[model samples]
Target: MRMALRALPLAFALAPLTAALTPIDALAQPNPAKMTFFITSAGLGNGADLGGLAGADQHCAMLAKAAGAGEHIWHAYLSTSATDGKPAVNARDRIGTGPWYNATGVMIAQSVAHLHDSTANTGKQTSLDEKGGMVNGRGDTPNTHDILTGSTPDGRAYPPGTDTTCNNWTSSGDGSARVGHHDRQGGGEFPTSWNAAHPSRGCSQDNLKASGGAALFYCFGIN
Candidate 1:
């Protein structure tokens, strides 16, 4: 009886601590099903200049890590144009070969071809963020539907000519970036294109907003 009394206080003291840790423990467990696709809830503040492709990839990895989905290799869906003798890079080539899913366990695409197909399973409905939250679209308040892709409608690098990638995602000052409509809504040409809507007037964050964007992009897990 004396021993039981002594243990009672200890149990009571530890109960709240264990209760506080319950949710954290649940979140810390690596999801066995895992996440494979997400639209970044935010972006690097320097406009479309994601410090080039490497920096963009790092951003994807960082966001995935924060969301407890860091086990898989993450890649940003952004294209780079060849300039100053450098070779061009396609956004399609960087992401892994498909079968991506949103945080809510919803599959986005089964393969690369399927991802770019007109019937792709992605859009405002499936293209959720790391938290499985819906991003605002063309008809939503503020209308942040434009997502940065920098690739053509076919997911290839733009031909050498006018700056179609904010100087290959390195300039947030004076260059322009190609954007897409995640909502598949109005953009005049390619209004229904999910990954290729139109271009930004300039590379600044405000400029991206002018075209109905919040400087966001898509991230995919390769592994």
Candidate 2:
């Protein structure tokens, strides 16, 4: 049994390396192809003017395609207030029925109700980008923690009286857009609210940057 005894040592030596590469918990690692929810890695770069919901949805589809998850239809988690006699569009309705997971396979929420609940698992850790990378939070340099949502705490659009959507997400000049803190920790009236934290300072890129934002938002798969 000398040959068998000699091979045992090599097997033991390779075990740790394999384990390190493939992590003991497979569910905790990146699984882009199966991801259903993620924060946008980057914004449309035009501040809050996402070319309306159509352009924002297009961005989501483009990003999903690049992540290899294009089979599923994607939608930006954004809401629109009534403008030009059009009815408001709710963010919750756009994302479809829930139960979404991040790129790392971590469940962000079980349903639409759960997504707005305080216990949703969409904190700085689980609210990962499509690349399975964490977005900057409070203590990080430049602090890009703000995520544009334009909806209230319950994922519905605000009343048309005030400008909480950057003029229905078409202006980058003087209007403000409602933003949420993705990290769930910041200085806002609802600092811990993941979808309805505060309003942005302005719609331009520089104005958004002033309030610790980079024009980012969330995306969810509908199918």
Candidate 3:
């Protein structure tokens, strides 16, 4: 993993603290999964209908299982417009409210959609040009891209630690800070660390390359 300059010193300080702890005690401790994470495009489509709530219950069940969620809830939503200025809304508006639920049929993640002209693709699973949106035309289409926020199953946000940027901050004309190629085909995990630092911007397709389409995920805290 590429260590950030600011995080390096903190990482070193924490190492010794960990060493002082008992191995068995640490090993036995359960690593709690946070409630927030970027849902895949496939997750959104499979989870909900355009405006109906019937499909979401089933979808959240599947999401909880796939994500190894413990007493946690998962959710999905649709976009009202296309990145290319096309009318995305159709008959699926009634099911806009999510079918949120827990492991035992208790509702957790709620469903909602935001309309924006973002160039970020909420589908696909590969790198692409900064301008290309989510990759649905290609193989393995995703359902939608969402900005992650809210409390965990137990209700907690991932702690802030590093700077996160999609496509290395290229989409909005931010200069490149990292060396990896932009994931144009979507289905990439939004950086939790970056989300903590730049919550106002949410997740964007700014730095992603334009040759291939990709989605953006952003993490944030529940109000």
Query: lDDT of each model, Cα atoms only?
Result: 0.85, 0.91, 0.28
Candidate structures ordered by lDDT, highest first:
2, 1, 3
Q: Tell me each candidate's TM-score.
A: 0.84, 0.90, 0.24
Clashes of each: 0, 0, 45
Ranking by TM-score: 2, 1, 3
lDDT of 2 by residue, 132-163 (tens): 88999899998989999999999999998999
C-alpha lDDT of residue 172 in model 2? 86
Candidate 2: list runs displaced more than 4 Å. 1-25
Per-residue lDDT for 117-173 in model 1, tens only? 887887887788887778999778898899999888878889898788998888888
Reference-based TM-score, model 3: 0.24
N/CA/C clash count, model 2: 0
> Model 2 — TM-score against the truth?
0.90
Candidate 3 wrong stretches, greater than 4 Å: 1-33, 41-60, 81-223
Q: Write the per-residue lDDT of candidate 3 for residues 133-173, one digit (tens) a residue.
A: 23233233332222222112111222223222212222233
